[model samples]
Target: MDIHFYKISISGIVQGVGFRPFVYNLAYKHNCIGEVYNDADGVLIKLGCKDIEVFLDELQALAPPLAKITKITQETIEPFERSDFVIRQSHDANSSTTILSPDIAMCDACKKELFDPTSKRYKYPFINCTHCGVRYSIIKNLPYDRINTAMGVFMMCDACKKEYEDPTSRMFHAQPIGCNDCGVKTFLHVNTTTIQKDTLYHTAELLKEGKLGAIKAVGGFHLVCDATDENTVQKLRQNKHRPTKPLAILVKDFAMAKKYGVFSEKEKEVLLSKEAPIVLVKKNRSDLASAIAPGIDKVGIMVASNPLHLLLFEYIDTPLVATSANLSGEPIITTKEDIEQKLPFVDFILDYNREIINAIDDSVVQVVDEKLCILRLARGYAPLHLKLPKKIDEKVLALGANQKASVAIAFEDNLILSPYIADLDTIESIEHFQSMIANFKRFYNFDFDVVLHDSHPAYESTKIAQTFDTKKVAITHHKAHLLSVMTEPSECVSFVFDGTGLGEDGELWGGEVFVAKERKYHFKPLVLLGGEKAIKECYRVALSKLFEVYPLDEVMELELDVVKRYKSKIPLLYHLFQSKKNLKTSSVGRLFDMVASIVGVLHEQTYEGEAGLRTEALVGTLTREKRFEFTIQEGVIDIAFDFFASDFVERFYATLCSIVITLAKQEEKKVLFSGGVWQNKTLLEFVISELQKENIPYTFNTIVPINDSGISVGQIMEYING
Candidate 1:
């Protein structure tokens, strides 16, 4: 019989996801004789088979669930003598091109074993197999193996070692394979006392008593408490200094999740996915404390994704308020010491001995217009890798905008993005950003040829870019937002609207329409009377808008709460508006703030997107829709409208939709939507419905975020197009 020898190279997320064992079994099934192993680039196979094409077809068709095969190539080679198909040790090279798998949720098999009394791993907090376990967060270096991960320090017991070596066992070659006999131990710390025995039981008891505890999770730490306890939830808010921002809840399973929130089919699928991100859904139960989301009708919900979390749920019945353990605008805390020192309100600490090399927060997503929209990309959805349309000659790094900071690195047709780093507003957040950059460099053994940053000169990311010892290029912020959603270099009309970004003309431009790469139109500029203070106190923007069309006495005569409350400061605010010395902005996000204040939804914002969220909530409460007049002339759009109408919020949204439709009609091209403002579901749905009715094509971000967290990816896209 004739034999064929072929060398196969496969790349993409093929490591630490049970790819090697799958390949080993596939080789035997195909009657092939050779070996499979991992290398720097990806999986490599040397096969001697009768029909290589048939084997290749089955390989792609029956690959593991978590494996993502991007590229596969085969080359004929000299036939070699091989007795049997086997798995070999990983081969490390100078540099790596393989994509790292994001951390995956616990598999059904592991969960089953965790609850089985007969199983050795029953009630074990760190049980994992090759099918599902920690990946990115525990990994320290490439060519993924036990020695290169946080699990290397733990020696496997006799039973675990036997299972690790057995090809038929699910734990075969699992990097994080461990059992209670020889793995990390959990401990509960309460008021200078350490409780080592029955820690999970004690932790659950404390949480049931409405005690706030910091629990170590797969990526970082979570400040956990009973979600139904209003007093505990309020205490968490005061202690964390996160006043009115919504907190996410962790449920035991889909049944428990359904009790608190109404999930669509698509939302349910994403919630149960391996990524296991927090999904925003309609609040269904009033039993949950009102303080959980206060004023917002939607609640963020996620299922327990890891073994430790699942085990905790076995003892606790109530949903747990699982907010990241960190200061406001800071990275998630990863160390036990840090959690104990920083979060003084934590009544106890549920911790383990395992080290967390990378600290990632939980990713957030929501279903918009029957499609998935990413809000915060981290944990199970990061260390994201995208294949470039074409290879680039130089290695590049993109430092994203300041608010929702993230970094991206592009090299050799591969673009890798870091997990969502918190806003670079504090010293700790800046340090976290720098550490993530350093981690990426070390992971890929990378040296950048150039770095890209926002045009905003004073942005912390821009300042850090100047410190980098490499060539730097500044791209306008709005343009970067536009390019992030564009798949190819084509002429299209893009509407980039957000709260703030530096324009090419050195003004704060957020409400902008661009044809191709050139800005074609913008909203009429509105003066921010107190600069940054206007953002925190949204009523100032409302007053400024009112002063734009009305005289001081006329504005004062209007019976508005803003005017009644700030009656004394109105004259000075009007003077600042007339002087125009304050920063000028064309921001639709500020428009939301203005409308929200006028409707008495909120006069001040405690969170980043509070005004927008409250305004969006009002869209559902409107009894009727009315027309609000607007004008487009001289490359500017005027949004001055009557603020006294009962349905002003509804009319304002309708007018914005009309503006987009009008622009699309004029441009006669596909429309691309981006920026943080698109996260407002009501407005985006309105525009989408109108565009579809008019038979106008439109596109938006699905893979990455539409917010500033995706700015780094957009910056790279801009550079590539240029």
Candidate 2:
């Protein structure tokens, strides 16, 4: 048989994920002689084969489990003599489209070897193999090799070296391959004492005593304590300065998780998957300390996604409150110095010597309408790659909204989103955002043709995009949200609701309904008093709406108890609304804030979406469905609030659903829900149920976050289409 010479290139999350080892084994099995190597672009394979079709089919069918092949290319090459298949060293040839894989949870095979006494990696804190281990978090650069990773410092031992060299061994060419003799070491610090011996065991003992410990995991440090200990949980909250925000806990397994939180079969599958994200589940038992989640009925829970955490369960039987080890509103702690400096209140610190190049936080998800929706995308779930429905000619960079920020890069028909970045208000978070953008540019090695940003000129991200030496496109914030989840180039009636975004008409838009066919708007503009300061004070928003339809004296005469309670602020708010001095906003989020303040649930916004979240939580208790009087005349919704009672919350949601369905019927188009407001479970459920009852087709974001974190994706989509 005559041999054929071929060169193949495979792209996507193929590096640092056993792709080379997989290619080496496949070549030997298929009786082909060639060399496989890694380069700046992706995997490069040169092969000499008699029947190339069979070889290519098998390789595609049996790629490594961790490898995600986004694109594959093959071409005829000049013949070269080679005796046998071999793995070659990685090279930095040129700008590459190859992207690093997100850090994956430890596979069961590695977990088994870690626990077996006969295995060389038994009881090893940093035990990892070819199939699973750290990837993006530890990687410093591309052509992902040991030298480009934090693990480069830990040279392999003789036993590991042998396995890494053997073609038949699972760890052949595994960059992170290591054994107990030559792996990262752990240390335990308790108060002023530092102990190198029995660190894991002693840390477990401390947790059992209701003491909090900062434990280093794959991404960053996590503050851990016994979840059953009320005082210990409370102490963690007080020290972290996180007063009422719910804490995430880590259980040993799915069965234990089910015992505390209700889980569906799909949810159980997600929890057991390699991603192992913190899943928000409804609480089934109240026996565990209520301080873990406080008044919230839903609790965020996760399982051990790494070896050290699984081993910790051996000494400690109960669940642990595993929250990010940083002060509230700060980035996650990665360096030991940060843990010591920022979180000195912890009883002990359990850490390893391995460096974390990218400090990622745990991803958080919730099941909405029986489908998983990402709340915060990071760790195993970020650097999200998606193939667009249509191809683009030039490369583009999209900067997301200011809050819950994320950056996206678009080239050809693909869009890759960076891991979720914090709000851009702080200096640290802004630096992190810029660093992520720089990293994406370096990794993809592309000259961006254009940069896309929110139309809000005041946004920091918008300002940053303007500084880039490329053509810039300003997309309306709500329009970007509508396009974020549009998988196809189709028109539909969309509802976009969030805290605030600059509208095309130069108004602050929070809640909006538009027909994509003509971009017609059907929204009631609610004037906001006090400009930017109005966001923090909900009473101003409530009084602003009251002043819109009533005389100043009549507004003062309203019988609402909350208005009476904060009677002093009404005079100033009324004057601001009358003069139109406080910026005019048509924001639905402010309406929620107004209602939240009116009911006396949340008066001031200490954090983003606080009023909306607290108001939605009340929906769980009130089963009564009532419709508040809302009138729609000449494309505006007018609600005359007669009372500020508990029933009004349910009424507002019900009325909103009715109006959306009515508009969808009139337009004769499917409905699309996008924005942060849909993140509210109560409002989402009501809207979904109403749509289903009317048999109206609707679509929501499943691949990306419904909030502004996904705005970058929409920005790219609109730019490409334009």
Candidate 3:
């Protein structure tokens, strides 16, 4: 038999996900003698076998569950004779092109092993295998090995070492494979006592008794309490300063999840996906605590993403509110010191030894139009990489929008986005954002040729962009939003809406409908009062909208609940509105706030999109056929129609859909929608329905997020396209 020798290289998401071990086993199975190793670029394999074609085919076809091979190149090479297949040590080079895998949910094999009574890992909280375990969060650098992670501190016991070394074992070359005897250990704290015995059981018991505490997970800490207990959930809200905003709940499984929220098949698929993101579904059980997600008709639910979470569920019957362990507008807590010092309200702490290098929050997603739409990209869905339509030769850094912030670095043809950074409002959040950028740059050895940021001069992210020692370019906020979803440049009528972004005209723009290819068009500019303060107070926005057409006396006399509720602030707001003391905004977000207030559903905005989400939620059983008339005067779209809040909300959405459809039909083009407002499921449904009715070929955000978290990608895209 004639033997052939070959060297192969594979790129993309090959490190830290058991790619080397997979290749080692596959080569051995094919009766080939070879060694596989991870390098700075990707996975490298050398094989000497008689039939190389079959080996290569099975290598790609029978790859591990977590392996994602993007590119593979092979060539004939002089291979030395080898006695056996081996997994070589990783090679550390000067440059990095390898993609990092996001954190994965615990696999079914690990789950079964964890619960098996006779198994050594019985009821082990940290049970994991090669196919499933923490990856991105624990990893500090590339060439993903145990030494580069927090798990480096724990030395594998003899039993674990044997399993890890044996080629026939499933745990072979599993970087995170460890049992309770040698892996990460969990410790529980109750009141003033810290106990290592039965930590998971104690934590579960405390949760069952309606206690609120911080529990360390794969990514970071989560403040948890019984979701079914109203008092406990209310206490959590009061302590966390998270009022009215919906909190994500962690259920036992799909069966328990069904009790709280109704899920579609697609939504179910996402819920059960390896990512295990928080899937937003329609609210069903009214018995859940109202404080969990007050005023909203939808709830975010997540099944167990880790063995620890599943272990806690064994002793508890009800769902748990597993919200991020951080103060409002701050980053999620990753360390024990941060949790103890920052969160004094937590009653107890369920801590773990394994360190989380990259502190990421849970990813939030919803199935929109049967597609999994990412809202807040993190955890299982982040450190995302995408190939641009055209190669970008310049090494560029993009500081995303201040709200829902994320950073992006473009090199070659790849755009790498960091996990979701919380809104850069407070000093802590800004520092966190800066740290993320610094870490990313250092990790990839990136030096910027140019920096891209929002056009808004006062934005924290833009301010950071200015401090960078590189050529700076500012992209209009709406333009970035519109371009973020576009793969290639095309003529399309785009509808971009959000709370506020600096327009090219130096005014705050949000409600914009324009020809994106031309980069010019009309907007519904509203009278904004009190500048930045108007964002928190929905009444001010409502008063401004009312005073736009009606006189002060007439507006005061109007039977609006918001006007009556904040009568004292009305006079001052009116004075400011007349004096033009506020920033002019063409913001659809403010319109939602105004309508939410005017309809008496909400009075203030405690969180981002609170008013808009509430308004969308209130459109409950209302028919979609009802739409109010809108006047497009000169070039601007005027929504100065008189209607109650509920009717106004529905009408506003229908009118926007109609406008986009009409504009698309007139221009003979497809419609593209982007922005934070696009996260509103109701409005998106309406627009999609309208477009489908007219058979319009409309494009929307599916790959990346529609919110400001996606702004970084758009900024980079803008630079590349230009």
Highest TM-score scorer = 1
Question: What lDDT is reached at residue 150 by model 1?
Answer: 95
Across residues 1-722, which tens digit of lDDT does each residue of candidate 1 receive? 56799999999999999989888888888789999999988899999999888899988999988888988999999989897998898898887788989999989899899989998898999888877889999999988889999999999999999988888888988989888889889989999999999898899999888899899998999999999999999999998999999999999999999999999899999999989999999899899989999898899999998988888887999999999999878889999899878998799999899999999999999988889899999988898898888899899999999998999999878888889998999999999999988987887786889999999999999999999898999989999999888455366889999999999999999999998889999999877879989988999999999998799999898898888888899998998888868888999889888988898889999988898899777774422135587789988999768888887788888888888889999999898889999998888888898889899998888778999988999899899879
Give the clashing residue pairs of candidate 3, or none: none
TM-score to native of every candidate shown: 0.98, 0.95, 0.97
RMSD of 1: 1.5
Q: Which of candidates 2 and 3 is the stronger one according to TM-score?
A: 3
Candidate 1, residue 128: how far the Cα is off, in Å: 2.0
Candidate lDDT values, in order: 0.90, 0.84, 0.85
lDDT of 2: 0.84
Backbone clashes, each candidate = 0, 1, 0
RMSD, candidate 3, Å: 1.7
lDDT of 3 by residue, 152-179 (tens): 8989999999999987777887888778
Off by over 4 Å in 2: 549-561, 620-625, 644-646
Worst 10 residues of 3 by lDDT: 620-629
Candidate 1's TM-score reads 0.98
**lDDT per residue (tens digit) for residues 1-722 in model 2:** 98899999888878988889898888888788999999887899999989888887887789888888888889999999888999998878657777778888888888888889998899897777677878889888888999989989988899999998998888888888887789888999888798988788899999998898899998899999999999999999999988878899999898789888999888888888788899988888987888887655688999988988988998888989999888877778898898888888988999898999888899988878888888888988877888888888888899999998999998877789888888888787888888888888777766789899999999999999988888999988988898998654256888887889998888788778878723455457777677888788887777777777788888788887657877887787777787866676767788888888777777777677777777776774322246676777877777666555558777777767777777888988889888888888778877888788889988888769999999999998888776
